[model samples]
Target chain A: MTDRSRTPAENAELALLLEVAGTPKPGNVDRHRDLDDLRFEQFLAGSVGSARGLRAAADGAPLGGAFERAVRGMSRQSGGNTQFGCLLLLTPLVSAAAAGDLTREAVRERCRVTTVDDAVAFYRAFEHVDVAVGDPPEGVDALDARRGSDAEPALRERGTTLWDVMELSADPDDGVPDTNAAEWIEGFPRTFDAAEAVLADDGAVLDRAARSFLRQLAAEPDTLVATTHGESVAESVRERAASTLAAVERTGSLDPAEALAEAFVDEGINPGTTADRVAAALFVALERGLAV
Target chain B: MTDRSRTPAENAELALLLEVAGTPKPGNVDRHRDLDDLRFEQFLAGSVGSARGLRAAADGAPLGGAFERAVRGMSRQSGGNTQFGCLLLLTPLVSAAAAGDLTREAVRERCRVTTVDDAVAFYRAFEHVDVAVGDPPEGVDALDARRGSDAEPALRERGTTLWDVMELSADPDDGVPDTNAAEWIEGFPRTFDAAEAVLADDGAVLDRAARSFLRQLAAEPDTLVATTHGESVAESVRERAASTLAAVERTGSLDPAEALAEAFVDEGINPGTTADRVAAALFVALERGLAV
Candidate 1:
């Protein structure tokens, strides 16, 4: 989405900013909506600061440590969970870029090296913000970030790596499949595929992002929506998105998508999981030089 | 615009983000517009990075060196002039915050201590981005940053410190008074005044900013608009802004301002100087703890 001559760190920063600057992102903190307790500007600061920190430490730190540090930085700066989902998705991508490759294999390789200490730090970072992670699998409640430092000992005793946590969270057949978890476990299939989509599509980068977001929302109900609202609400939102995209196809305009976004916001339904996926997609697109 | 529980640095970052996030700014790369070369995301990245860098160095670095480093840091990340005017205004204000006093006197005292090396570094930073600066007064052609290193010796020989340059630029009665210069020379009267305005306003901070921006534009023709589009066009834009504000006053709504913004964007008119003033004002408001 920017000039290709920039460093990977610079592009990573740009990717984070673009992720927040996406207008009409509906109930999420896009340009149009600034929540009473949380401002969009705070999110902007957190995202940029975290992206820069991740890129700077990507080469030296293991994936889990880097991710924890980035998240901690954002929490300290923003005083909220402004971009926890984004940090989870972007950490490995930045690591891959620092490794001289931007590929799913590279990201997975980086994730494979995460240690138990990294998991402890990751849990510790959660004390700084109210990240919206749903309830964990029944037995793995010890892995819950909201458990704070209390979960660290069990994580240590189980020798449960960050990747193990991702694998558990990523099981699509499970009752709850986090978009971030799915990307981590499946070698970031959707992230890479979305990068390819951006390359194939023709328009401004923001417009492409909007289209990609709709496609993702139409394809599946958002996990965040399901968690915060309900399965029925999420399913209805997905169906509405599909119909809106179909209308866009018929009318060749985004007016329907805009209307759909307004309705989602009016209903207080935030497809945050899908928004996180779009951030990951935009990161991949920027990393691979998909935008001219 | 954000929770007051944040640190001064975090508040500074929020100010930068809020400044640029103002929507429908009309041809100035607000939320709705991204130029062919410069994206709104780049501006976001620039503002956040600069704010962070400024705050991080505020306690130790001399005001001039801090300003140069922040600008250089932004250039490294964004590769453009997204907030040159803003950096000029914020650096001194951040210094004041770091000095445990958020006052024009404190900022002036900070600027008064800048040396010749800071001046040279300031010019050196100019090489990294295409900042929009007007020509200097007579006998100061050698002070122009466009001359690059060629001006260094002259600056040293003339003993023209950064403060002296600010004094020259701050002459508000000058044919081309820089908004940044006016803040520096006049001890930031306008910035402080706008902060008072925000404190008195009864609404969302973003809406306060929108109203403050329109008022600032209506009060005076933006020098950036004058430099780029000539005095007559700038004056006409200011007149339209005045009329729009009058309509808003009559109707108690921003619809008139929105309509005027649409027309301004269509005509390629950007009141960038007013936008910079608004950023300075937001910084002052944040520094003074003016928030609901």
Candidate 2:
């Protein structure tokens, strides 16, 4: 890893670009895969323009307000939901990076400072993209992200901070955590661990990232995969990934992974939530001195 | 193309990013293709960082110094050549964009004002990247770009401006023009024409870019191809591209171009010069409101 210093903006941009550029991630919109209505360039533009506001979130700016502006900037350029998951993951990490501590404790400290206004701003950002979020638990209908401005008064009445809302959705008791909410409630354990994995792997950074992604998917069934495809299908995909990774480990060839990627893409089983984890992991890696 | 107002920096970044993200341009190191040493992420980093310096160049900062700084910034992130050709083509155009007149005459006017110090700085930028420029013309060995700082005094003695050097290298007498120098002396005719073509093409922005690239490569034997492979080989490649384009037009499919791309990538024959021109064209297209 090169020991180059970086501003939070540069780090945020690199994390997002690296996320999209990793090839054969199977089922995901990679460099080679341009989904209809959601091309790769839109993602590139969103990531490039988002660095400033993401950095500001870590530099004492309100996270929700910064996120809203960044999302708006992204929407103006892309007019698509390219990197919504990534922005969800990166905003807090960017804040953690700016705070000069990448620890889970530090990130939790950052998240804890969020206010009802922050929750309102976070919901406002949802106006820009069609993110697939699970329904809020019973009796929280008024706080639905899809409700837009109508949710604001409810959020204000409850005096719920963004952290409180994340706690509501983290679903820790379910054994399979909701990705973004889990990051907030648990102070981003998976993100930090994935970064550790990035540093331990030894190869070209992109190749390492690709390998790490397979490991990530194999280790945890993606939340997005579960959301779109049923839980059984998501589990099956995870098992397939595990087997593919085992073969690569045995033969030291990336060929099997390529085949697995083809199958995943053909079936339209995109594990986008896992890809978001990779993005956050990469940010941690960069902050810890992973070279380009 | 976005109706949204853009600063010169935003325009430059978008153009550079879009240029590299144009997929299946084959043989060029784009989003899908990473050379052993030069990864796609590095190119993204280089382009992201250079926007500021390019904007400075257009904002009445001495063109040479600004260009040198921009190249240096790219090198710092990439640790290798990434967008030297693009920057050379963009410097004048960026200046034109900042001047609020992207017309050929306005661009020429911008070029004309470049000072000898600008020539020195242009030479300084050469230290950062291994740009594929031919040898200097006879009797002007003192103006060699590869000479770095050693060429400075000679440039000073001759009172050469950056525009003057480009004029010598433009080689209007040669029937085949150097893409970079030719743009300088002729006020970017091909670049402008390519932009017009982009606007005229109807499809997704990337598809339009890919089509424009094929057309550009078909129209000219890329100087880079000619330099690496013999002139005969370059001519043969151009002929193949033309026929491929003809087949695509006849069938209304980019499938034929995909086949051509496969052949070129297999042969390690890259028409990089043509790709650079396409980038300039895309910029012009965006500047003129060719929606993505």
Candidate 3:
């Protein structure tokens, strides 16, 4: 409510402007408990689809048919960002975040199911349907309204959450991959070589187990950094390594070994052989220690 | 990320933007997941003066500090419409939506005492130190440097969350209050007449039991509307009611009975006396078969 002179549209615009620019109304603090839970849900729900999904789901029935009519009616008032966020939160993102396992790919693959059914399943599981519509306005009805559109149309933008897919791609949501084959890959072996080469150059920066991790990082930067760096070094490594790779990854062809050589050389971390470079660095560190 | 041509700042920005935004690189995804967890925890773990709550808690300190900072930070972000929204949410303006009970304030309060000492002192129990961390950043490492600060600081501006407090003004974080007294005062038979007067047109629009919830609504319209119209409406009701009450409350001019009578009469719901005014609409709603 900016000034008395504002119009309805101005008032509406003010609401948004105030949103990114307003101050707190300290006098009337709601201070309720479920506040966080409610807000969290609001920021996260909603799904995406297309007229095709709607048509397929409807089998090309008339738009005003009983079910289709309900769908049409609801869609008119159906919240856009709110609904999208809900679908994103309820379906893709939850699986990405809630997967039993801890890998990025697993999280992504699991979240690929961004269908209404996926949302229904998630809500049924996540929200206690037995929950009473006790609060005024009783928003659980929207859950029912949301379910009504299950067989309804969706937007492409709503299909998958950017956040969820990103997470799953890097980390497996659950289940470890078969590293047996992963370790044998020859292309990645070069990274380990480079790591060893760097280590060989500056074992001065190395430690006892640090050599092993460095070797690991070089061998399979994905799993190596994923497991070793945890959140910190892993994130930086991936980003930095990607930058290096991007510079070389041009020409539209991706070769793991080539990517590593380019990234490693670009980073000034020698790219030779994984274990050898690791050994080279650790040997230097150990020798420096021994000399001391 | 911004559709701008390539630059170093853009390059660095893109890496974070892509990792956070999710990209082709596999490891980049992992970083996103870790950062997201931090983003979600931004409010919960945020401290009074601390940048991030998860980092602070992991480093070890009372949970209150981070959340308080989040509250202050979030409050600062919403510049103008705060009062407008607060007024609508407080009064009966947004009577169409409300979600649940357990609010962030309650949880924030929960975090305040998430320590072994506090738990032992009050509940006479103890929890593991990292219990406050909830689930660890799904694929994150504790010692990682990249996790230090991400888009989480920016995510902190999402705006105020008052659903819980609107439903129930007394927050768990503010220490104990005689909520039993508040509850008793709400449930008294003497409230129905006041309820009728407040119901505007009639107890007709509200479910029977919904009338009973009016006093609770008055206490915290924001939370009750969580189930009703969603957050927007919840906020509207609170803002309107608060502004009206604030306008009249300080005068101490009108007799309580007359003031309440006028409020109900204005609503077109007639109540003969203060006591009748409280009971009048509630009885009408119950008689009309509107379920709260």
Q: By DockQ thresholds, what CAPRI class is model 3?
A: incorrect
DockQ of 1: 0.25
**Per-residue lDDT value at A155 in model 2:** 95
- lDDT tens digits, residue span B66-118, model 3: 22221222222112111111111111110110111122233233333333222
Q: Please give the ranking of all candidate structures by lDDT, highest first, separated by commas.
A: 2, 1, 3
Candidate 2 chain A least-lDDT 10 residues: A1-10
List TM-score per model, in order: 0.86, 0.89, 0.21
Give model 1's clash tally.
Answer: 0
The superposed Cα distance between candidate 1 and the true structure at residue A59, in angstroms, equals 5.9
Top candidate, metric DockQ: 2
Kindly report which residue stretches of model 2 are placed more than 4 angstroms away from their true locations once superposed. Answer: A1-6, A58-60, A77-79, A172-177, B1-8, B55-60, B77-79, B172-177, B229-233, B266-268
> What would the per-residue lDDT of candidate 2 be over residues B1-292, giving only the tens digit for each residue?
2234555656666788888777667667666666556677888778766765776877878778888877876765644777777777887788888778889998887788888999999998887777766666667778778998789999999899999878877774333457777888888999999999889889777778788888988998888888777789889989998898899889987878777777787898988888888878888888788654
DockQ of each: 0.25, 0.34, 0.02
| Candidate 1 residue lDDT tens string, B1-292 | 2222445555565676777776655556666566556776667667655754586556667666677767766664443788877778887887777677888787777778888887887787677678777777776678887876688999899987887877777673345766677677778888888888977887666678788888888888888888788789888989988898888879988778777777877787878778887888887887676552
- Report the lDDT tens digits of candidate 2 across residue range A176-234: 45777788878888889989999998877777777778988999888888878878998
For candidate 3, the per-residue lDDT at A40 reads 13
